[model samples]
Target: MKNLLLIFFIITLIACNQSVNKISLDIRVDGMSCSHSCAPFIKRKLIKTEGVLEAEVSYEKKLAEIVFNSSAISKEEIVKKIESIADGIYKASIIKASTKETNLKKPSSLNNRESLDFNLTKPGISHSSGFQLPNLFSLLNSILK
Candidate 1:
């Protein structure tokens, strides 16, 4: 029974690590008229997409930053998804793409009236809140030992 429990914990930790294929993509969006409706509209659609973990759209900068699991979806598919919104009113192009080892912290719920503030500019800055999966795994490993 003890051996079985140890194996289960190891498997769980491996599975958690393998599932996170987080990719951060910066996209340039065209044809947004205002920050009020256009930005939120695009943000809502992007967040609803499968494999999309987070999306931040700014009409003032005409930029959309999205974080998703590449294993579940491709960047090209995301760009196409954007272009297909609102009867093709928006055009999207990838500005930059980078792979992230961990997920970024974001609000659990966003108000329609509130705007997202992007503060993830500095390198090596993590805004993760609460206990993360990796930390849990580490604790389990220590306990098992």
Candidate 2:
């Protein structure tokens, strides 16, 4: 019985595997004076946002580079998420955002779907939040100062 279940699970993982489409966002954020203090705050928020796969913020450049699923989230929505943080204190302006579908060939056989390169996550935040992350700009300001 265990062997049968394991085989079924393995087959399910194999059947569901497919190429992914990715979108990249480059945003220039205003009202940030320091990178170390502000960028982390921005990154923490973006990573928590729905549809965001990976996000990097550079305070020195006042820019945010985010990778996400365009089909699931739009550029406008991403900007809204950014601005929503700190009660609209951070002004986010888009420099450019583009998307492309990846067309890599599927491997002849996948022994383990878990071993494949995957940074995917479900879109949106859960009610529990899983962990607490700081989103305070005033305290950050005081610490930086």
Candidate 3:
């Protein structure tokens, strides 16, 4: 009976840790209009954070979903990073972080998505025409400070 109890406890701990990996937030951004221009900066910042395994930013939905190791990080820190990255261009806040999965894609496959369209010649943020990421990042950084 003691052995069974120990096994259950171990399993419970693992399960709890696993649940900590998934996080999502809804960010209110001022300058974000499309995916191409704004997403890469946000993605870069989130993925570089210690525990984050995956980070997805949606311009249309104005949301950022991040998957990370709970043991190495916390929801509060993630929120701070989002706010920092978004800076003056965007305002970020935690909508909620639950065991429920918000984003289903893995980080390795992010490049394959149809949303990344920095090569286009569009002037604004929209569905068909992507924004200019490099320029936008500079603009956003300037605005942030």
Candidate 4:
């Protein structure tokens, strides 16, 4: 019985480790109007990133299908790099994963109003409470006075 259980555990571990991972990413980017001209650059950059074994780009669909080692890389990293290259160019969908898990959604910015659901009191700003710095002329006048 113990031997059978051990065998099952080993099999499970192997399955998890060797599982295939593929991510479907939509790259809505500028400066890439033509696939013939830009496909190679996209492919090269993606391939350089960790765990990416293959990157296939479709010009018509503007989609990038990437096969990678999930243990080494993540969907978020890919999206971040794509966005960094040419602002707002990455939308990732995890078609498959070796671990069968999803990553937590992180806020894009600290001041994202839409995602702010925390309870907080609203404070009013007063005109008199605003910044008031004495001018150089005023300083001179005060000294003269």
Candidate 5:
């Protein structure tokens, strides 16, 4: 009975990890003269993608916001999808990608607000602020020396 329960628990964990999770992405799309050529087309293409759940393109802002299922596709595939269409008229680069929990109560008007959710899972040397600043006092001491 204990062995059966353990097997069930392991299966549940694997299923959760393999679930079709949704992720939101912010992309800076270049190479389009939004006024004359490509914003609407790009938005349409993204919406038509197999795993894309939602897409919002802003011509004036040069931003392509997308929500997609990660299990069905990857971020690299999304970038490639844009570059492969329309003689390569649109080029997209990711600015941010996140899997933040969706807020059911938040108003639609506040959906696209900026956030600073940084993931620290990779192997690297990290500082408190993630960057170093010059010490003004050290500079003054050097001048005196």
Candidate 6:
């Protein structure tokens, strides 16, 4: 009975470690032209990848958000997998990466899909290349005068 109890404890520890090693990655994928074909194709490929828990690909946003176990695969390997798809036609760049500890005590529900919050750029920040719309309009008005 004592040996059985020890084995149960070991198994529980391993299960907890597996859930703690999960990482979420957001990648920006370029070269996808349409939502119908490119998006679904990438999604399917990502789902087939080993260690990937969830993959959401959006052609309109040109982004691929993936969750996987770090123990099974590295972030670089995931990026390489995306780039290698379609004979290397796609280019993938990491936008954001985060580590999340999944709660294993409660059963995960299929209807409960957690959303990732990403701030791709700083708030109230804008960059311009020495060209302003108001300046262009003023120049046009002056020329007309």
Query: TM-score for every candidate vs. truth?
Result: 0.62, 0.56, 0.52, 0.42, 0.55, 0.58
Which regions of candidate 6 are displaced past 4 Å? 1-20, 101-145
Best by TM-score: 1
Q: What lDDT tens digits, residue by residue, belong to model 4 across residues 1-145?
A: 9999896576555444454454434444344577775655566677666556556655666666665555556777776766565455544444443433223222222122221343233466322211222233433455569
Model 1 regions more than 4 Å off: 1-18, 101-108, 111-145
Of 2 and 6, the candidate ahead on TM-score is 6
TM-score of 6: 0.58
Which residue pairs overlap in candidate 6's backbone?
A: none
- Which model is ahead, 1 or 4, in terms of TM-score? 1
Give the top-scoring candidate (lDDT): 1
Model 4, runs deviating above 4 Å: 1-31, 86-145
TM-score, predicted candidate 3 vs. hidden true structure: 0.52
How high is the lDDT of residue 40 in model 3? 71
C-alpha displacement of 144 in model 1, angstroms? Answer: 34
Alpha-carbon deviation at 106 in model 4, angstroms: 35
List ranges where model 3 is wrong by over 4 Å. 1-34, 86-88, 111-145
Indicate whether candidate 4 or candidate 6 has the larger lDDT.
6
- What is the C-alpha lDDT profile of model 6 across 1-145, one tens digit per residue? 9999896576555444433256988899999988889977887787667667677787988998887768667999999999999999999999988896333212212211221223324679553322211223333355569
Would you list the C-alpha lDDT of every candidate in the order shown? Answer: 0.75, 0.65, 0.59, 0.50, 0.67, 0.68
Models, CA RMSD each: 9.4, 15.8, 15.4, 26.5, 19.5, 24.0
- Global lDDT of model 3: 0.59
Q: Per-residue error at 70 for model 1, in Å?
A: 0.3
Number of backbone clashes in candidate 3: 0
Clashes of 4: 0
* Residue-by-residue lDDT tens digits, candidate 2, 1-145: 9999896566555434523347877899997867667777777777767556667777888888887757457889999888888888899989987775222223312111222234234567323322232223433355569
